[model samples]
Target: MPALTVLTGAATAAYSAALVARPQLLQRPAGLARNRDARTLTRLVGVRDTAIGLAMVLAPAGPARRAAVGARVASDWGDAAVLGVALRGRGTWGKTVGFAALWGAVCLAALRYDER
Candidate 1:
């Protein structure tokens, strides 16, 4: 169960990073930027993610900690879904930066764990 807790933590961090990066990736899309509402929402999401990442980086046990924790868990889940879809007895590209980046953040956060 404790192992699962760490796995979930990593997944949550990855997912949150993915959420943060998705906006920067879509910012250049012509169709997406055309709609004012879409643009506004995207910007807001970017801001939110940036804020969350900053918060996670700043303090772990603060209010944002729960979100940071969730992001870690969700990220592993998303990656698993991607891998299952792309590698289940079928040849497909399992290439993407989102999950990798999130996993990286998980490692960063884990550095501060007391393991007590």
Candidate 2:
């Protein structure tokens, strides 16, 4: 579980970085233009994910780890909501939904591990 958490963090942070640095590649997948507003929002997402990823990697296990997992859960749900709103009625919306659901599942699994 710990390893998975770390991997998730790393992956998310990397992906977020890509989105912020070169959103053009994601224009189709994300269904967002590479405009100023979109880039700004994408950078914000990068910042959020970077913070969460770092917390997950650096926080101690037990309570600290659990707290990070909780944060991850919150972040995932929030992302899902944002995606739902932004991607509404869009054909590529499912991609964002799937991304959020995948992370949400990871967070939930981490929470379940914490319960044990």
Candidate 3:
């Protein structure tokens, strides 16, 4: 379970880094307009993800770690809701929403094994 948590965190952190470094990675695929505002928003989301991922990875086993994982799960769900509405009728809507919801589920399931 710890290993699973660590792996998930690492993956999130890496993806966040990529998003921060290249906003186009998310913008182009999500069919969002490529503009300064979009890039800024994307990078902000990246920063948020990075912080949450690091918290999950670095927090010790127990409630603190569990909370961190919970945050990640919550964040994903929020993303799904926001993106689902924003991307409605777009080609990338399904892909974006599906990924967010699925990832949120995965993170939520991991809570079962959290050493509380």
User: Which structure among the candidates has the greatest lDDT?
Assistant: 3
Show where candidate 1 strays beyond 4 Å.
Answer: 1-25, 29-33, 60-69, 72-116
How do the residues 7-115 of candidate 1 rate in per-residue lDDT, one tens digit apiece? 5444444544564546545434222343566556655655554444544554545345555645543544554465556445542323333454555445445534523
- Please give the RMSD to the true structure for each candidate, in Å: 8.7, 2.2, 1.7
Report how far off residue 64 is in candidate 2 (Å): 1.2
Two-way TM-score contest, 1 vs 3, winner? 3
Q: Where does the lowest 10-residue lDDT sum fall in candidate 3?
A: 107-116
The TM-score of candidate 3 is: 0.92
Ranking the candidates on lDDT from highest down gives 3, 2, 1
Pairs of residues at least 3 apart in sequence or in different chains that clash in candidate 2: none
Put down candidate 2 lDDT per residue, 1-116, tens digits, no spaces: 35666666677667767767776656668688778887777788777877887777777767886787778778888888888898999998888778787787886686576456
TM-scores for all predictions:
0.37, 0.83, 0.92
- Name the lDDT of candidate 2: 0.75
Question: Worst ten-residue run, lDDT, model 1?
Answer: 90-99
Off by over 4 Å in 3: 114-116
Q: In each prediction, how many residue pairs overlap at the backbone (N, C-alpha, C within less than 3 A)?
A: 11, 0, 0
Who wins the TM-score comparison? 3
